[model samples]
Target chain A: MAGENALNFQMIEAAAGRLAGHVRETPLLNSPFIDAIAGRRVWVKAECLQHTGSFKFRGGWSAVSALEGAGGVLAYSSGNHAQGVAAAARAHGREAVIVMPEDAPAVKIANTRAYGAEVVLYDRATGDREAIGAELAEARGLTLIRPYDEPLVIAGQGTCGLEIARQAAEAGVTGGDVIVCCGGGGLTSGIALALERTAPGFRVRPAEPEGFDDVARSLASGMIQKNNALGGSICDAIVTPQPGELTFPIMQRLCGPGVAVSDEEALRAVAQAFLRLKIVVEPGGAVALASALFQGDAIEGEDVVVVVSGGNVDAGVFAEAIRTYGDAA
Target chain B: MAGENALNFQMIEAAAGRLAGHVRETPLLNSPFIDAIAGRRVWVKAECLQHTGSFKFRGGWSAVSALEGAGGVLAYSSGNHAQGVAAAARAHGREAVIVMPEDAPAVKIANTRAYGAEVVLYDRATGDREAIGAELAEARGLTLIRPYDEPLVIAGQGTCGLEIARQAAEAGVTGGDVIVCCGGGGLTSGIALALERTAPGFRVRPAEPEGFDDVARSLASGMIQKNNALGGSICDAIVTPQPGELTFPIMQRLCGPGVAVSDEEALRAVAQAFLRLKIVVEPGGAVALASALFQGDAIEGEDVVVVVSGGNVDAGVFAEAIRTYGDAA
Candidate 1:
């Protein structure tokens, strides 16, 4: 579990070069309104506007590209990652097979299919998508693209942090802290590695939903912990029971103190982003903003960067979230 | 009246240079999904993400910058224009006095003041904002910045269409048809002039909310038509009763065809934009999209551009709009 040979500046630089024409260099938006509220400077990396509506595309594209000469790819994801894999595979003229839970949102399923992937649905109660994906990969000799555990994937996600660092420098802001919403530690670990190489003086922090605090617990205990009984949360995108083995160690070594916020806080943050920044962010994407807003005192008086991880919520869910939290404010 | 020599491409070019460093060159997004729905190639000019959440800032900044060396400026508006004027004036290091209706949203008032403008509220039923603005201008010898009627303001607004043309060209798509949501004809007229100069083959069309179809009526009559009974619509931004005298002739001469859409259509378009594009566009901004979606046959098989004019809605109003149209498929 020692952070030996983990992601570093070199890997991130290579990832950027590989992803130059493949993925979008999403805008890093400075929020004067949010800054006034938090009494500190806040810049938001809007990955919500990325292709396939999330940063998952970065990792998927990077992994598929790295395995260029390999067969097609197989992945197991219920949402954004599914679309990402599908898109990345199509972009490289390779076939992608996504194992998704049958109960996944129709919009997500449609998006996955739209990216030209064949989706295999399994019952969430009794089926194991990983086993199905493994079988498929073995049968077809396709590479199993792990969502976060792979070095290539982590390097790809690091490009987001690289862009943030570059944009911040271009905007004349020297250095500060970078905050990212953690699900399986993919984005957070990648950002940490990217900042370490690009903006060495900057600190990287991970923000997680309150109920699914596996990363926080893992960091505290120095071991990955499973929270199978925690059930679903509004930030469903980050509801992983345990972090990937490859990502956990890097995250532990490079990420700053992890912070957790309530489902209500995340929902409010989504609504706040829509109201203040006129950007629609999914619940998981809003976790970083939630941490910055409700926990302002924790990282006060320093320039802060919040990673808006995605924007792919169902209209019904978005409306419900807005009604519940938008009205409360 | 024939089109006057008052507004010209040279003036708009100058305005573009003057406002270059001040305003954001908002994105012009191409959507294959929207194209499939509308049966044409559709590009959306996302002014919803513009500074102060509207295209008004372009003209506001141009007008204020033109007179910053003179003295203070006064404007009369109850909505987005007021905020834009205040922000632009403040950015130019001048004082702004805004005459707003008493019933204007508190958010608009707060936003105007946040930019350091003095907000003077008057009862819409009895008070004349124009008289108040004139008096303030006379007493202080300050320049009166009209919301849409002035030549400089029109030139400034033209910059949006200029950017649209440039973006379209950069994306390898050239002239076709451009649809702009019209209020008092400022944006449509300005955009028409810009497109005529830059993309000469491109046709400009103004889309108006049904009851306030003054632009359409004015174009048909060859004169500005006043409709005092224009009903309240969800598109509060472009619900003006009449086309501006200065804006009408230019619009009639240069704009190809005018279209009208229902408030429900506008609301649905807003929901679609939020869900599909992750951008919050106000009802007026959505009008162009609505026209495209509902009246696709009007401009069939053409490379169409829809201007998403603004994004400044109160949470309550936005929630209501979402609830009403978000599930419309």
Candidate 2:
């Protein structure tokens, strides 16, 4: 059931019911700053304010809650997914252990532990976190919850798209372009499914960091593509090597060719959000907004909806972003 | 009607009906960081993301929509109230003329004009803006929209408290204490009326800046209290000299003795909000949060709701806050 290939509208609907009151229905922000950049109106789905500071929590809760027994959860992630799993596990009264990279941001690590998750750090250069997570899961009788590939996780992520469609309708928008921050493509694929069923005319696209434009390249080439290297971009949370095996098929079916933004552009998007939207968005989270702002010419829409994926950023890094891009004011 | 002595629940309910589709129903945020500070649950009503970046728009729209025919609207404000009035007037297809201090944040002045309001700048030190507003209103045959003193304005601000009670009830908080950032007491007085009507037993308190705590002192002394200085603090949004005669009576009757926080404390609260809540809050907007965090022992109730009043701050000031108080992370 976890490795299932397809996530349907029914499963997503059920997930929404399960997560009805558990997760926050983050606001759909309309900022003039983003509108000016696009030369058109822009709607922002502020997923940054979601519990544990990311959209990953939706999937985390969905997966952990569906686990068969009281075996608890074992997950591997750089930061956001780790916090999601940890927070969900704590809420469900299940034990959690996260296999995180040794160099994950100090804030994310602290936040993960604050949810009562035991941390097992692995060296990013020398160790395989997935292997460590699998071994830990097997040794401790824990269910291994994949960050994105699982059908339950994908269904959980689809709930955000449901919210997007509802909020757009409430704001009197019939259809427009939708941008999703992409790493392993879980969020993109999930949103694609939800929008397909709900707001059928609304199209979806992936936005990725320059060095880690795996999803964009894959979408263009009609096949899987791997990033050249990790740790090359400032958007550390989304530094996945490649798109997820399960998520890629769904993306190819429903999404368009995507846009890639530089780290500098993402930081500018982050600063713009602070100045105009008054929301704190992390680097990975800002990529979709970066694409909307910097790649405005390529984006075709009357109203662009950019999903700001998370807000779990290092304070020093966020401060520097404000200092660098905030000089214009 | 403009300088009415009292506003009631029925008026606020009618204002809510008028404001239903015009304004953003800003979210009530639950944050663990704030919860830890008070050793209890904390819910923040983020009015900072409201149209024109403050709760002032509620009053602005409420007032302009109820005005007499063909005359347009005139208002005096530092920034938030100006933008609100301008935006409300623009939406209602009425001309807006604003009397603002020349040294107001560049963003505010620009936003006001962006909404098609005529900008008339005055020196805060040497000029009387109310007189300027009055002159412009009489010359243009426009209805003057007082920032906080009017009954309609107070009713508009009351909508925020109405939202708070509704949102808190949805979150399963039966009863709690509410801390509102006070300027001329419009928001506090309005909220006092709403909570009294909708969510009885929830006590409300005013939180103000140290030197400019006119509402706080007034509540304590059971009489009007004036600030010794008008511009010593960085909170430019809530620098009213004294409580409004119309609003002060409502505050004194329904609110507890207020708590005042220093400029330094307000800045810390602003930074804390950024790091934890991922929301940009102006110094004036964060004073309620400041009181909740610093005056922990004094604050009663298992649940506390703090209203973050506005987010219309200059980018440079927000950047400085991140640098100054974000050192821990």
Interface RMSD of each: 2.6, 1.9
Candidate 1 structure, TM-score to reference: 0.93
CAPRI band of model 1?
Answer: acceptable
lDDT of 1 by residue, B1-329 (tens): 22458779998999999987568777666544566678887888888778788999999998888773658888888888887889888887898999998888887888888878999899989988888888888998888888788988999999998998887887667877788999888888899999898888788889988878888888888777876675578787788878888888788788877899998889888877776678888888899998887798777447788999888876766777777766524
lDDT (Cα, 0-100) at A255 in candidate 2: 95
Q: What DockQ do the predictions score, one after another? A: 0.47, 0.62
lDDT of 1 by residue, A145-238 (tens): 8788878888899899888888888766767777899988889989888888778877888888886888888888888887765467888888
lDDT of 2 by residue, A1-329 (tens): 44434578888998898899998999999866568767888899999989878999999998887777778899887688888899899999999999888887677777888888999999988999878887888889988888888989999999999999999999888687899999888888999999999999899999999878899899899989998898778887887989998899999999988998999999999988887788889999999998888898878878888999999776778888887895434
True contacts kept of 1: 0.46
**Each candidate's lDDT (Cα)?**
0.83, 0.87
Quote the positional error of residue A244 for candidate 2 in Å.
Answer: 0.6
After superposing candidate 1 on the true structure, give the runs of residues whose Cα lies further than 4 Å from its correct spot.
A1-18, A66-71, A220-222, A225-230, A324-329, B1-6, B30-32, B300-302, B327-329
| Residue B261, model 2, lDDT | 91
**Candidate 2, which CAPRI tier?**
medium
TM-score of each: 0.93, 0.97
Question: Which tens-of-lDDT digit does each residue in B13-111 have in candidate 2?
Answer: 999999998889999987676788768898999999887778999999999988877778888886788889998999889999998889977767888
Q: Relative to the unseen true structure, what is the C-alpha lDDT of residue A56 in candidate 2, on a scale of 0 to 100? A: 96
